[model samples]
Target: MQRYFETELLDVKNFELPKEIYKHAIVVMRAKVGDHFELVTADQKVHLMEVTAITKTAATAKEIEVFEQLTELPVETTIVCGLSKGDKAEFIVQKGTELGADHFVFFKGEYSVAKWDDKKQKKKLARLEKIALAAAEQSHRTTIPTVAYLSSLQELTLAADEKGLIAYEEAAKEGEKGALVTLLKEIKVAPKETKRPKLQAIFGPEGGLAFQEVTALEERGYIRAGLGPRIMRAETAPLYLLSSLSFALELR
Candidate 1:
């Protein structure tokens, strides 16, 4: 069955589809009254829905089943990357959502090759948000990942209990490979006071993170971790982190 997001969650068991979703299902997909599809509501609940009725302007679906099935990572993950040029950011949000990223942050690095002015930030962020939403639906995710931008590294902030990691290529070269594993194991026992357990990993742009920026993040309690021995491109490193997290948390 196909899946789509419902922005306004309804209390009624039978609900009407929004205009855009109506156009896609009723008009574009040419779905009939008996067809079924999965629906993710605002409350993040997944509903197996069956189309019950259709009018000229809208269609309705009856909630067939409510699924409590887990489709998200056990730990909330935010992938932070230094803003890069071209379509890299879009690729990160698109593929990252499929790989279970809960959120994405892009910031201006000391050696950033691309710049996003205020207007560009708004436009690009809007486009990226759409990419995240579509990817989430396509990936059958219960929750849609968010995309955000920061002017500089200084603007990036973390909660006291949130585990933060900076992907440092230098750490990989120095044979530092245990930090990521250690952090993954430790976050399971992170302070219980943390309302939403979070793990945010930072990656640099094509030019990589500046040494001073790494030092500052370390001072703020972010661990510098190496993703194996080989150096990955800025976009590749976050995906590696997510894959590792899934293997350690989901598989084991």
Candidate 2:
């Protein structure tokens, strides 16, 4: 069954699919009346839907069952990377979304090989956003991660309740590995009214993050953490982090 994230499914029983979703449901998927699919609404609940009607240009579905479940990371994660050359950003966003990242952020690092100017920033973000949406749906995620850019590393900041990390290759060289382990080993507790804690980790581009850039971010409360003894490519590091997080936060 196909799954879509819909923000307008509240207090409603039946509705026409959005234009994009209509095309996918009616034309692409060849769904007929009485067919079943899934919808994840703003509340993050999964609803089983039955196709109620279908026209050449439109389709409608009705929710018959709602499943209250959690399909997100125990802690919200934001993947912040220095802009890279080529399609690395898209690859990162796609795989990262599937692996349960809550947000994706790109910034200009002191050693970044690519740059997004004011003229093309919107277009770049749009492409990444599309990839994230597809990956989220394919991965059966209830929420789609967001993509955004920062003008510079200095613009990156975290809330007092959030944890921030910088994936500095040098940390791995110096055998500094306790920060990430400690973070993952500790227990996280929150009241029903509050949300899980958030984590935002930064990765460098091809040449890796400059020491000075790491120093500046450290001042903003970002701790330097090592992924492992074996260094990873710019695009590979974020996925590694997401997998480790899933192992500790989800599987454990």
Candidate 3:
């Protein structure tokens, strides 16, 4: 069944699908009256819905069942990456959303070769947002991950107040390991009255982070950690970190 994230589904006899969703549902998917799909509302509740009626431009659906389950990460994880060249940003956002990232933050690093002009920045971000939405829907995620742009590493660090880990290549060279596992264990346990803890991991661009950049981040409470002994590209590091997190938190 198709799944859509809908902000309006409260106390309504019938809910109208948005224009994008309607076109895909009716024309693309050939959705008809009595066809079933899933809707995730603003309250983060998943509801089974059936198409009640179809107009020329839109389709209406009614809730049939409310699911009593959730499919989110145990800990809210955000991946921050330095802006890289080519389609690496899109690749990160798309795969990261499917892997259960709560948010994606991109910042301009000192070593970044690609620079986004004002005109290009808006278009690029919109495209990335759409990719995240599509990935979230396909993955059956109740909540779509958000995409953010940061002007600098300082802004990125200030925005994330949780456990911040920098994927430092130097750390890997020095044989640093087990930091992620220890941090995951610490955040995995929370009081009954508290929500899950948040974690943010930062990765550098192609040339990697400058020494001064690493020092600044370390001074701001960011822990230097390595994914493994093998060094990864700017795009590969975040995906690697996310996979490790899923294995530790979801599979274990």
Winner on lDDT (1 vs 3): 1
RMSD of each: 1.7, 1.6, 1.6
Candidate 3 residues 92-171, lDDT tens each? 99999988999998888999998777888889899999999899889999888988888789875544437889899999
TM-score of each: 0.94, 0.95, 0.94
lDDT of 1 by residue, 136-169 (tens): 9888998999999988888777886688999999
Q: For candidate 1, what is the TM-score?
A: 0.94
**By TM-score, is 2 or 3 better?**
2
Stretches of candidate 2 exceeding 4 Å from the true structure: 10-12, 187-193
Query: In angstroms, how far off is 77's CA in candidate 3?
Result: 1.2
* CA lDDT of each prediction against the hidden true structure: 0.88, 0.88, 0.86
List pairs with backbone clashes in candidate 3. Answer: none
Q: Superposing every Cα of model 2 onto the true structure, what RMSD results?
A: 1.6
**lDDT (tens digit, per residue) of candidate 2 on 83-146:** 9899999999999999999999999888887899987899999999999998988899999999
